[model samples]
Target: MFETLSALFFAHVLADYVFQTAKMVQTKDRFGSMALHTITVYLCAVVALGSIAWQIAVLAGLHLAIDALKVLWVKTRDDDGIKPYLADQVAHFITIAAIAAVAPTLWADGIWTKDLAQGGLLDISAWAPKMMLLTAGAIYTTRAGGFAVGKLMTPFAAGAPTESLPKGGMMIGILERGLIFLMFLAGQPAGIGFLIAAKSVLRFDAASKNEKAEYVIIGTLASFSWAIAIAIFTLAINNGLNDAPLLEIMAAKD
Candidate 1:
């Protein structure tokens, strides 16, 4: 577990660096904004530790809460503007948590080994390439999805007033995609933790009723879809890796 986690950490760091670079390139003079965003996110994460069930419930709850607050705050403050749609953010968290919850079973089934952890962190260093590939894949997939969605919405946005959109739509897009990339690189739980922290800071502003409702709907769908996807992916990865015999071994012990 430790070895896997270590690899995950490195992958996460690398992916985050790349994502940050991309953001800088897109926004130009965005240093202050990025610094503030990172600091705020870290602070929120620190505060979240005080919540009950810090490992499980708190982590997931925090993610949900932040997104909920963000939508609510935005709508309330900018009633005339388009609100930040949080459907994707909510869905990503749900998917990550559901998958992570079941990951232990995969290990038990020998999809990977707890022994992998025993190998000492250095022993697994060779796996960095594979991990990097996974990280890259996640980043690509998330950016692709966002671009596709943006393109689809572009046509309708032409006649629509920009002010009709939420004040932080672009920021939300960057953060949402960044969080997803981080989660894929670092593992789901960590990713969720980061998002919860970021979202908390965003919630200082309140949302309007319609905005809140929209957020609720988007969050609800995203969470549900994520849960389903994680389960499917976990199972698929396990089977594809040919761990049935290991699972049988585990089953017999049980």
Candidate 2:
């Protein structure tokens, strides 16, 4: 069940973030484009959940409604902000959770309790269960985390004239956090420093001035801090869930 849910969630991350192009994203409000996108979502769900036609239909239906609502919401917005992004994810998660809980075979064993623990390291929570945690972190640190950082910088940004970024800062923040999170998972702290250095160099021309420099520092730190915190928590949770059992330890000796 845990593995199944992880597959489903990862499918979502793949479809929504990794596979969906910027062009697709920009045009989702129109019926034809959205229909194409919805088919992709359905295909993802089916691939993850298997050949169950009804289950695929349900997931696809909910995903479409949720995404359509989001497109309309964004279309009406003055400029993009965090709440809608978070809310959209929240609604999708709820739908996923419901399906995970109510679906036939999946519903019965969805929980990741000790009963599912077996098969030495292969069956360990670290290998199977933690995949979900990592995938979820990847998904959240994208637009969702970007939105959070935006909110954090609101006070600093208030009344200040907006500086239009040639490359959208939203996407940049997503990549930054996602990379940092992966670095933490890989146990490579130095990569994060390198990332910061690279980013600073990129922005130095604009941020060399006093006011811009201060804002850049604050935003950069805040983004780094959020990513680092999530990485730490993810590692910690994976460790806890994957703690070695006496049985597994004994088996290791054999």
Candidate 3:
């Protein structure tokens, strides 16, 4: 059941975060756009959940239904804020959990497993589960975390200056979180301090008494906090999945 849940959640993260595009999100209220997003979800679920065609279909169908309702609710309320985003995500999670509960066999007969048998891309080694978990963690930390933190900062961003470089903030957050994730996995947690210090120094001005400064501080803190939490949690899970400690696992690779 745990394995099934992990695979399903991985698939969900990929479908909802990594694969979802800005265009898909922007026009999701339209039937064609919504259906396209659902197809992406279905394809991801198929790869993760394997030959359980009926179960995968159910999961995708539920996802589409939930998304549709969320779009309608948001449109009616004219609110595309953090609250609705969080609620929609929670609903999708519940749907995934329900599917995992009923499809425990998926872990054993999963598509990845079949691929391994066919001399395909994946190898069913001891690291296989950890690899999947790490992949999911990476995506969540960089992509999903960006959306979450952006929503969180929405209220504070009103009337703020718009003289910054285009897409600069988004790219910075992505790279920051990605680096933090790697540093933690490499057992070099202290490197984060240097990264933070560098960022602060680069952003520091002769004076710090303005909305722009405060805004940057808030976004930076939120991004750092989210990345740190995810990295720690991922490391804990990775430890549980292995007989060796994290350091020892790294040593073996050396």
Candidate 4:
């Protein structure tokens, strides 16, 4: 069951995040152009459910349905805020879980088979499959996290600078979260402290007014909070994927 869920989850991430580009996202929302992107999602589901003809259709159909609902909702309300994105992802993943629970047989014969496991993928570890998931999570945390921060920090935005660097906040959020991700993967949480200290030292400005100071403080705290939360989540999920529960891993020193 875990294997099936992991496989389909990775496929969903690939379809929604990696394969679907910015242009694809914009074009997909239009009523008539939904088919191509939907097919791409189906293709991803097929890759995950290879040779399981019935399951392929099942997952693909469900995926298309969820996506269509999202697109339609976006079109009708004309609100492309973070709410829609969150709703869209939550709906799709929930559907995937429900379908997989009800029809585990659909994924039983796919990628997790012993024959395939020992053949071309003999050298691969469970971590290999998990890497795909972590990569997708990292991407989502950066973009989605930034949008979330922007939304939450709206009233506080008035005191903030119009611009700090070129593509500044977005790029910084991505890099900061990416670094935090690496720190978690490497099991060095102390690195995060150093990162924070470095940022504080650099952005130290005594002459800056109180409002901008408060703005920077809030934004930095928000960014770091998001990064830390995601780092912990990525580590926890990857541990599960590797079949090492967090408690057991924490207990091990040998």
Using lDDT as the measure, which candidate wins?
Answer: 3
What is the Cα-based lDDT of residue 132 in candidate 1?
Answer: 34
What are the lDDT scores of the predictions, listed in order?
0.38, 0.66, 0.77, 0.66
Count clashes in each candidate, considering only residues at least 3 apart in sequence or on different chains. 12, 0, 0, 0
lDDT of 4 by residue, 105-130 (tens): 54455554434545432333334446
Task: Please write out the lDDT profile of model 2 over residues 1-254, one tens digit for every residue.
Answer: 44445556766777787678878877887788788887888777665544445776788789999988887787887444666666787898778767765663442232322243531122233354455557766775665567678866776774332458664666678889989887776767679889988998988875787767777888888888878876665565445445533122111110
Residue 109, model 1: lDDT of: 29
TM-score, cand. 3 vs. native: 0.80
TM for candidate 1 is: 0.30
Compared with the true structure, model 4 gives a TM-score of 0.75
**Which candidate should be chosen as best, given TM-score against the real structure?**
3
Q: List the residue pairs that clash in candidate 2.
A: none
Which stretch of 10 consecutive residues in model 3 shows the poorest summed lDDT?
245-254
List the candidate 4 regions with Cα displacement exceeding 4 Å: 49-53, 75-78, 103-108, 111-127, 143-160, 206-208, 246-254
Deviating ranges (above 4 Å) for candidate 3? 114-127, 158-164, 243-254
lDDT of 1 at 59: 35
The regions of model 1 sitting more than 4 angstroms off are 1-132, 151-168, 188-206, 209-254
Error of 3 at 148 (Å): 1.8
Q: lDDT score, residue 187, model 3? A: 77
